[model samples]
Target: MAEKAESLDLIWEVTEIARLIGRTERQTFHMLQSGQLPAKKVGGRWVAERGTLIRFFMETAA
Candidate 1:
């Protein structure tokens, strides 16, 4: 089962995000590099805020 929002980590790695979005890791990385996805590099790994990603897609969705 998934953790509750209050217990969930605010940050998500590229692989996790990829799974969430139903895309492969490579595709997710490409989107991140091309500015299509919002993320930041920390300690050599790509990460994004759960809330930020949710809002981004919600606001920009067609």
Candidate 2:
């Protein structure tokens, strides 16, 4: 489905997620390990949804 394909693009690697959130890799990893970030460990790598991260920051920024 088109939605499925589009969803694929929403998945971001840890590095990209860190840059988007303006945090260093170490900080991002720490947050991920502590369950502070809206991400999950997939296949031994941290993966996060782009929109979810954006929305999380937007909501929390208020």
Candidate 2 residues 1-62, lDDT tens each?
Answer: 98886766455567887898999988988999999998988888888888788889999999
Cα miss at 26, model 2 (Å)? 0.6
Q: Per-residue lDDT for 1-62 in model 1, tens only?
A: 45575664556678898886678989998998898988888888888877788888889885
Q: What is candidate 2's CA lDDT for residue 42?
A: 84
| lDDT over C-alpha atoms for residue 9 of model 2 | 43
**Total backbone collisions for each predicted model:** 0, 0
Backbone clash tally (model 1): 0
lDDT of 1: 0.80
Question: Which residue pairs come into collision in candidate 1?
Answer: none
Each candidate's lDDT (Cα)? 0.80, 0.84
